[model samples]
Target: MSALDKALNYSKKVGINECEIVFIKKKTTTARITDSRIVEIKHNFDEDYGIRVIHEKKIASVRTTKPQEIEKTIDLALKSASGVRPRNFWRGLPENIASNQLSGVYDEKLHKISAKETMDIAQIMINSAENSKINTITGSLNIVSENFTIVNSNGLNVEDNATYISGIINAESEQSTIPVSGIGHVSSRTLKSFSPEQIGNEAQIMCTKSINPQKVDSGKYSIIFEPYSVGELLAFVVASNFNFKTFTEKKSCFSNNFQEEIAVNQLNLIDDPHIPEGLGTKSFDDEGIKTQKIKLIENGIFKNTFSNLFDSYKEGKYSTGNAIRIGSPMGRSSEPIPSCAPHNIKINSGDRSQEEMIKNTSNGLLVGRLWYTYAVNPIKGDFSCTARSGIRIIKDGRIIGPGKSVRIIHSLPKMLKNISEIGNDQRNVIQWASLPSITPSIKVEEITVNSI
Candidate 1:
């Protein structure tokens, strides 16, 4: 029997009214860079199945690596649900939703991307940097083979599979303007399908920019956030904001601001998992819900919030198919029941050039990325973070010098209102996050920049 069939038949047999199965399999390899060369490599392969059952107002989750364990797990799930307290706002499970067949996000050739291919690319990066006075090179490649099956007790079944190839490169330079920069990224379900030369050149440029970073006095200024740097902010947004649960819990700033034109009426933020070959691409979500593109911010106005099956049932809204289960082998958690979260949050890019935006600034900071950011209040959108790689710029378009641990304390809505410009430059970033969030570089006029 198929995974969906297994989940459905088991739920009925166990006297449980509703159930869902999330089945996933993955294979991957990763390599690290040290002393300007690869010093380590690791390979991993994992396969597992999890069942979540909601019966008689209670929910139970169980998982097993071996198929033999599925029956026991199902039995345990039903028994556990029976004895447990009813859910806080218990509602019946959902029917399996169907989705439009989309292309460009899955690859049939991902497994063919060999270890030899990655090793060759790593060598090229090292050689290029060494030739440019960038005496050292450090980087990594992550490739994965993933298959997923989502099924529910309701008439729902999904079969999805894809491959992913991604690379992260970091390089340091002898100059100071851009001392340490080299954020490289490419994702597709296929091997060697991304541009090595394009990403390589990016790393080279960022390293060069930081080599001799300029510095200016700390104060209010116009700030231009590069694409990779903005990605850090997107990660935070996906993690804390835009969730219907968070909104109901009074933990989201966008809750009260819905339909309000908060930004420049030109900016939009969208979460999309349907892009072909995208690392976050999927045909169905954790709840066996079909997925689609969702606009969180439309023309600078806050749009509707996202609700998963269970959450929507409680919130009295239709599901938006934004059910993401993070951190455990492609959404398979052996121990914890997965919660619905966002997959890809992208800030629509604006039309201004990076240089033009910089020149428009009389005095301000130019941030490469945000680091160590934390929320003071998700409802109010207050955040505090340090500038990771950047310079303080003055009116004449001159960057003064590189900054050290510069701090920025600001509010999200206020910052959006300060949108003086958004650059045409964009990038896909995977920072130190649970999952990478896609974003574009942006600029806001007169954000209070301070470091004493």
Candidate 2:
């Protein structure tokens, strides 16, 4: 019998009410870039196991790097459970999970890629960003392939194979009047779709364009946020308000506004697990529940919230298959307990182009990237972020020149209501150790910025 089978059998023999096991086997390759060159390449393989045991309705979890220590891990978990509080609302684990193989989430080439080839890919990123105006290029390329398995006492056993590749390049220029920088990034599940060239070229373009930036005045103006900045906002400010746990506890900003119109009629936000080549694409959640597309917002109205088995059961509902054990370098982890998280938060495409949005603006700033983004007050939907680079000042329907750094303090509810346009240039975005989002340029009006 396999380790999972043996662990489960042993758990029942030990008088455990229920048990669950998660195993993760991962291979990671990373290429670090610095000083306009490939600096280092590293490869690692790891196996991790997580054991969860329930004794007398109380739950406890333990994690171990040694699979042979699973029995000991289970014992530790059971002993830990003795002093823990019981979840009387817990309905137990699901039985006999069914899932379909998702497309565009796995690639044979990435799964078997060598360290030499990874360095070659990193070199491509460096070469593409090479420019006379660019003085430095720094970034990282990460490729990961992982096997994830879950087994529970309720006869649920399932496994999946997934691969991911992501690259980013930051180009800095000293040739400019003031030192300026730009960034480029792309992520994919397939090798064929990954674009190192685009990453470098974009960084170079942004850096070169940001020469001699003009100062931004402290005033209210329209702002067009690019995909990367939008993703940052989504990850740090907006995504959590839709969490079922947050909503039920009245901690969400929109807790009392459910089923009400929250944004403009043109907006639609969805948690989609089935998008092609999406980094978060998967057939099942970490808890062995089948995944599905959920519309968090539709036609300007709040629609639904996502949850895992534990959160859903607490509210007398079923799981929405949003449980995730986020791993480092990019994939699922062998966490004994999973948390509620979206698979892929996506803003459905709109018909307007970014160029059109820029042209229509009377006075605005085109923000390409954001830094130090966070929620100042999550319950009030207040957020703050700094526009550091790739900022262009627009006047009279034209981009006159690059702009200097500015700090924005805004309300999320107000921003949503003031959205003027949504761009069609959707791109996949994943922040380091953060959420994965698919977004485009989102234009909002009457936002105030303080010169920094």
Candidate 3:
């Protein structure tokens, strides 16, 4: 019998009321580059199982990699469940099992990529930076192939295959007395969608432009946030405010603003799990619930929130198929308990081009990336972040010169309402395993930038 079958049968023998087992096998290959050369190449293969047992509305979980020890793990879970209070709002696992497929989620080329191929890609990126006169280049290339299977006693059996390729390139120019760095990154589900040369070139350009910096007075000014910067802000400050659990508990910024205009009329956001080449694309969630496209914000109005089974049960609502095993800084793990998270956050493109937004700005700061961003007061939508690199000052509808690092303290809802222009150059971005977003450059008026 298969491992899943064995686990389920053993659960039945133990007289468990309900059981679910998630089996995941993954292969990862990584190449690291430093000083414009390949520094290390590593490969890893991992397999793990996460088991959940429910007895009389009491739920317990266990995770292990050893197949022979699954029974012991299950027993331990049962023991744990016996000591815990029953969940009053516990709802049964999903019962419907259907066949579904997502396009561009699995690619044979990415799964079959070898160490040499990854090294070659790294070399190409390094060469591109070097060609642009960058003094140093550091980056990493990661390729992953994962097999996920979910089986539960409620007649749910599902399996999926997925592949991911991601790369980041950072360039530094030694010509300057103070070191300045630029970063470029690409994340995709297919191999052909990545462009190492483009990543390298963009980093090189940013590094070159940031050779010498000027300081600006601390004041409110127009700010143009590039896609990557917007992604960082969304990941750290805005994303969690839409959680159903948090909203229902009155802990989110949007708790009292549902169905209200929280942003400008041009702003629309969607959580889509079926976008082609999206890094988070999947047919179903971790709980074996079918995934669907959800409109979180429509024409500036807060529309809907995402939820997992537990949260849905608590709210007396159906699952939105947003159950996700929280991943680490590197990527997704198979051992963690499921929670609600967005799949691929797509911000609808606007009519204005990036060039037009820049040309029309009379006075503003152009930010290519943001770092060390976090919510200072999530309930109040207040946040702080640093413009670490690729910051340029715009004057009279033209870029004057690069600017020094600055800190921004702002409010999320107010900033969303202050959006004056949005660019059409939308790009896919993944920030430290936190958020997978497709966004475009945006210009927000009267943001507070402080000199530090």
Candidate 4:
């Protein structure tokens, strides 16, 4: 029997009303440059099993890296499901989907780059940054390739995989600092698209700006966010809501606001895993179901959520191909629970130069970078963050000095509605040391800041 067939037979033999098995295998090689020196060269292999069992329409899940422990894990899941109450909302899986290719999501060179090549790239960043305006450089380059298989009793057998390579570099100075980073997205199928030097230079510029920062008074002011910062804002607005399981269970802030538009009418958020050469691209979710590019928000209206097979079954809806079985610390729960979550995310582009956005602000803060951000509530859009790599924008179009760290406390809707302009510079921000999100600079009318 195939992997899916074995999984299904195991479920039936074990008296499981329904069951699904997800298998994931991954390999990664990483290179990091520190102070013009290659500091780290590492490679890792990962594999895991995610199993779900249903009883009385209730669901319980667990993942195990040890094959020996899977039976016990399944027992725990079955017991958990049996103890819980069932709901009609436990819809069945979607019908069989024909196989389709969502290629161009991985790159081979990123994974196979020689140690010499990787270290040389890092050396370039350190040398260039130290030479360019007072700046310090820190960066990492990661090449990852993964494959996943989904098998279930319901004749659902799906398999897909992709490759991704990404890097991040930062240049900071005590004098004037503006955080800037470079990013690119392509599949192992596409090599000409990857550029490591480009990423290095972007970081160098932001770090050099740290020379002489202008200290401005703290207060509510108009603001513009750079690409990574923009991605941060969008992740808070877009990803939180799609976390349906978290929201519905009250584990997330977006749990309460189920019926509302949470962004400006001009804002559109999407998860485009199907985009050619985009990171986090996949053909099927953890459930072996075909994946899709879900438009989470359109014209500021809240659309559907991203859910895994179990969540889809629980909510009586279709799967969003958002399930990630395992990888990273949070991708798998601290406990043995199934690891399912969103992967690729893309925001529709907006057109306007950074200079134009600054000019549009009249008088406000030019936010260069954001740090120390956490969501007070994902559903409600409550956030607090610090500002760096910033400057004060006067009535004229010229740039000034640094702005103080301010607290951005507001719901997603109000915050996005305050957008006065958007930048023409769009950034691909994966491997941001967090979730991958693509974003551009955005201007907001006012943001509240408090002094230390």
Candidate 5:
């Protein structure tokens, strides 16, 4: 029997009313690049098990890396449960989980990749940037394989395997004196779709374009946000506004706006977990609930919010299969308990191409990426962020020149409503410590940009 099975059986023997155990194993290969060369390669292997026990509606959880310590961990969890107050809204663990397979989420070759191979890929990326006349290239590549097993006292048992490859590359122009830089990134479930060369080339091109940048006056002006910037905005500022817990507690800006139009009539957003090769694709969520596509906004109308088991129970709703545990830096982990989070947030593509959007703009700023983005006042949909790199000014539907960093203070709801155009060129992107998203370039009208 697996550790999960043994733990569940032991919990039953100890008279625990209900329990769930999750086991996770991860293998990771990482390569760090600096100054157009491979600097280091590291390999890691980790395994951990987490157990949750419920006694008379009280819940407690414990995690441990040592298999031999499972018994002690259970005892600790039970002891912890004793002091906790019973939750009247607590519902039992999910049962009768169906076995389903998600395509493009697992690759045997990724599991077999070696440290040398990862390093070689990293080297190729650096070389590509150097060949483009970049003075410096720096980034990290991570290849991960994960194994998961879930078991509960309700006779639910399931296992899943997945692979991921992700990288970030930055390039600096050789002739630029202002320390301009560009960044590119990629994430995929298989090595076949991973492209280190494309990442490097993109960074190099952006860095070259950003040399000797000028400063634009701070004022209200139209703005174009590239795919990466859109990902940053949504992941950090917008996604949480649809959390069932936050909505139910009246802490979200959209709390009372359900079924109302909150954005442009052309806007549609979906939380999809079954997208092929998507970074967030999964067949089942952390609670062993089947995952499905959820239309968060349909034609600018707020359609639904995401919920995990606990939050759903609190609101007397069913789980949306949005239960998630924040993965470790290297990959998946069993250390954290489940919470509500988006899977793959897909902003439906629009009709206009990026070039068309740029050509049609009379005067605006194009932001390639956003830095240090956060919600200044979440309840009011107020957001603040910095456009630090890859910024360009547009004048009379022409690219004028690159611009220096600028700060933006905007309202999310107002910005969404002011969207004038959306590009069809969607790209998959994940911001730092945020959810994965697929987005395209979007143009918004009259945003507040401030000099900093």
Candidate 6:
């Protein structure tokens, strides 16, 4: 019998009220780049089991790498459950989960990719960023393939196969007055959609253009945020505001704005789990709940929030299939307990192209990337971030020159309402150990910038 079945039967024999076991078999290949060259390449294989047990309304969990000790792990979890407070509202685990395999979420080439092939791909990234003006290049490439299984005492059993590949390049230049850098990144589940050349070429071009940056005067100007920067905003600032728990607890800025217009009519934000090649795409959530597309903001109105089983049951609701056990580097983990998160935060594209958006701007700053982005006051919707690289000054519908770094202190509520344009150039984006988002360039009007 499989370890999962063995654990489930053992839990039942031990008189446990409920039990669930999550098993993960992961293989990862990675290449690290530094000083304009490939520095290290490594491969690792790991297996882990996470077991959760419930006795009379009390729940506990334990993780183990040794499948042979599964029964001992269950015993520990049962012992651990005795001391925990009871949750009378806790509903039982899902039973008979049914889900279809999603297309483009797994790739044979990436799953069995050799280290030499990985090095070759890394070299492509390094070669594309090579230029006399570039002083150094740094970034990483990660390819992950995982088999995830979940089984519970309620006869629930689900398994999924997934693959992920992502590459990033950061090119630095000291040819100008001060050190300036540019970034390039791409992520996909299928190798056909991944582009190492684009990653390098973009970094080279941005770094080359930002050779000599003029000072950006402090003032309120229209700002255009490219996809990467928009993804940063989505991951660090915007996403949490729609969490069901956060909203129920009155911690979200939009807590009281349900069914109200909170953004421009051109905006539509969704948590989509079935998009092709999405990093977070899967047939079901970590807890064996079938995944679905959820509209968080529909045509500017606050529509819905996402939740996992525990948080949803506490408030008499159901899971949105967002339960996740995010692993290190990338992909899912056997974390015992699952937390709620979006599958993929996607902003529906508008009709305007990026060039058209830029042409319409009379005076603006084009920001390509952001750093140290965080919410200053989440309740009040205030945020702060640094525009560190790929900044360009626009005057009379023309990009005049690159600009220096600047700090922005803005309001999310105000920014959403002031969105003037949303570009059609949507792309997949994933930040390091953060959320995955698909977004496009966004233009917001009359935002203040402080010289830094």
TM-score of every candidate relative to the true structure: 0.90, 0.99, 0.98, 0.83, 0.98, 0.99
Total backbone clashes of candidate 6, pairs 3 or more residues apart or in separate chains: 0
Candidate-wise lDDT, in order? 0.68, 0.93, 0.87, 0.62, 0.87, 0.94
Q: What local lDDT does model 6 show for residue 308?
A: 96
Best by lDDT, which number?
A: 6
Return the TM-score for candidate 6, rounded to 2 decimals: 0.99
Which runs of model 4 end up more than 4 angstroms from their true locations? 1-8, 56-58, 66-89, 93-95, 132-135, 174-191, 242-263, 312-315, 329-343, 377-380, 390-395, 431-433
Sequence-dependent TM-score of model 2:
0.99
| Better-scoring candidate (lDDT), 4 or 5 | 5
Select the stronger candidate by TM-score from 3 and 6: 6
Q: On residues 1-452, what C-alpha lDDT tens digit does candidate 2 reach at each position?
A: 99889999999999898999999999999999999888899999999998888778899999999778888888899989999999999988878777777889999999999989999999999999999989999999999999999999999999999999999999999887789999999999999999999999889988989989999999999999999999999999999999999999998999999999999999999999999888899989999999999999999999999999899989999999999999997999988989988899999888889889999999999999999999999999999999999999999999999999999999999999999999999999999999899998999999999999
Give me the displacement of residue 257 in model 3, in angstroms: 0.9
Listed per candidate, the RMSD to the true structure in angstroms reads 2.8, 0.8, 1.3, 4.1, 1.2, 0.7
Tens digits of per-residue lDDT, candidate 1, 1-452, equal 76457657777986887777777777776667776888867778887887888887788888888876777888888878778888666565567566554575555555655677667766665555553646466777666666666677777776666666667666666554344554455444555456655555666655665555444456776778887667777676435678889988888876677788877787888877776555566766666667778888888888867778778878666678877666432323333366776667777778888778777777766776677777777678998777755443446786655555467888988888888788887555666535556666788876776763
lDDT of 5: 0.87
Question: What is candidate 4's lDDT per residue for 1-452, written digit by digit as tens?
Answer: 45445556667888887777777677766777665556898878788777877677887878788766666777888988877788667666545667676657655665466767766755655555564454346667666666666666677776665666666666555443433332222122344666665666655565554445555666677777777777666555446656778767776554554546766777777877666665555676555566777777777776756777667667666666676654541122112234455565666768888777766665677665666677776656677776644444445555665444455565555676787676767656643545566666777876776543
Clash count in backbone of candidate 3:
0
Per-residue alpha-carbon lDDT of candidate 5 for residues 263-378, written as tens digits (9 for 90 to 100): 99999989999998888888888888999999999999999999999999877788999988767553356854787888899899999987888899998999998999999999
Model 6: worst 10 consecutive residues (lDDT sum): 91-100
Model 3 scores a C-alpha lDDT of 0.87
Error of 5 at 117 (Å): 1.3
Candidate 6 local Cα displacement, residue 387, angstroms: 0.8
